[model samples]
Target: MNLESLVNLAGEAAVLATGGLLIGMAFGGFAQVSKFCLRSAVIEFSKGLLGSKVAVWLLTFSAAVVSTQAVIGFGSLDVTGARQLAARGSLSGSLIGGVMFGAGMILARGCASRLLVLSATGNLRALLSGLVLTIVAQASLRGALSPAREMLSELWTVQGGPSRNLLSLVDGVPQFGLWLGVAWLACALWLARRARIGYLIEASAVGVGLAVGAGWLFTYSVSQVSFAPVQVKSISFTGPSADTLMGLINSPSLTLGFDTGLVPGVFAGSLLAALITREWKVQGFHDGPSMWRYLIGAALMGFGGMLAGGCAVGAGVTGGAIFALTAWMALAAMWIGAVITHLVVDGAVAGSVLAEPLVDQSSGR
Candidate 1:
């Protein structure tokens, strides 16, 4: 259906929400089948292994970059008004928040989107963590933690427009983003081939990327045709999760929009994928310590994601696709933070365990 027809029939908000639901479903299904998790990719890379996880992540990232850039290059989408580009941004918040989110994902064993996908597959740990994340995100957005988030965000701010656009910063580089995406796609394809990843998995990864691109395209299309003001945005879990949670709590006051449909759409899509693959199996925390770890991690992710203005997929893939400066910074910070945390927590623990026997001899154990 055309944008105008759909908008006329269901209203602009409903159309946007429907579009979000479809795009979110695609993302959910693709992510589920591909096992696309930035946290896993980070852990694998930190361990110095270029394995399937990294390959899958690269495929998704490259595909998202390529698809989004292609649309922009063809003049099919204009992201100048998107919040990632148009609004004032925070360098301090991106750096600190990205680091916190990365570390939290490691402790929680999943990122925001990953947690949602896992929760649908009967992971009680993920479900609880996701709920905690939503609550904390809501708190950070407008509740008890808003002041702190605002304070940190104000520490370092960048004006919107050209400054936020990384492509604009480069001089005389024509179609830079498209070319860069092409190069990345080539690399990803090579890695995927070398790793002998299944075709289905690779395709699913690409599908996830396409879904991101679709989100941008769909929203922009709606904004162009609708008389009502609609925000041109793509997929991002942080704000959407908080909004969705609040909508659930305040059903009478809920407003329909893209974000209003995204979370539930993703959940439903992931659930369907899991059921089809017979991967739906209930799982939960094994101990109190682990439960506490997840809770703390979820809280950190919630606040950090809100502070950063995006999560892993949000800033890393969606915003990165458009080459937003803060998004790239946040993405880099996430990788760095994940690597450092992995070394300190996982690596250090392993080292200590290995040294335990040597120390036991000195203690005559």
Candidate 2:
């Protein structure tokens, strides 16, 4: 709050931001190259297609779990100490929020991270969606809509012992983490081996996992050194986006944090990749209908993400890494929501939304 305190906070934020920048760039480049969209993966799986992207996502999740837990086992990180991972979690919030976010991604035609990448690549539609997402998410977190989120979270919250992770529940059974990680890795390997772009997919999957796992380590390390109140978190777009936008007009106290750096880092990293790969293009709304759809969809995602405690990357990957029940349940709910949206909006019956051309354009080795 004072001048000296402000200077220290700024220095700490700068150091944390540097780490975030490196992680974001690595993730962005890989995401662009592999076209790793969570929405696309859900759609593809629902459509009965065993896609490589899904495999890559699973591999990343497994790797993150393995690496992060190893750190916890070695006393390097304390995820359970984080408020979000407290013993009590909101089941209803996760379900409702996941459903909303999943359906919204379908309507918006992309997830939060996808929009971030698209925005960096000069997509006007994504830019608008990003802005809406930031504003709405902020509202849900601390503004007018926060009451609704709190009510839902309180109504259905449940307690799960001293710690919510699988290891703790099972009394720190070492083999559980080992087997879970192995099973996931095995499935990912099988998927990668069967894909047309096997080698590329495998490499990208490993890179994404390393990036995510390393991000947790970096942030945790910074938290240790700062003596300031910095939360231990990894790659999550919803809160970070809102924090970045709000931090602009507010005091440094509001803006100086890990999420603040991460949101912009993702965009900057994606922009760098787009330029390097010559994929940057200025795209805009095709008409009024598209604009309206994006606005509604972004708002939905914003609300859902805040209520559920994270977006696709947040709950899906980061939360999943720690074997959190909330993450898995939310992910399942999101997938179901996406399926229903595809059926009603796309007018598809008992099939996936991923047609061949859509796959070609969105995903290619």
After TM-score superposition, the amount by which residue 318's alpha carbon in candidate 1 deviates from its true location, in angstroms, is: 0.6
Candidate 1: the clashing residue pairs are none
Question: Of the candidates shown, which would achieve the greatest lDDT relative to the real structure?
Answer: 1
Q: In order, how many clashes per candidate? A: 0, 1
In candidate 1, stretches whose alpha carbon ends up further than 4 angstroms from where it belongs are 350-365
Candidate 1, residue 34: the lDDT equals 88
State candidate 1's TM-score: 0.95
Per-residue C-alpha lDDT of model 2 across residues 5-26, encoded as one tens digit per residue: 5436667777777678778877
For each candidate, the alpha-carbon lDDT, in order, equals 0.86, 0.76
Give candidate 2's whole-model lDDT.
0.76
Per-model TM-score on C-alpha atoms: 0.95, 0.88
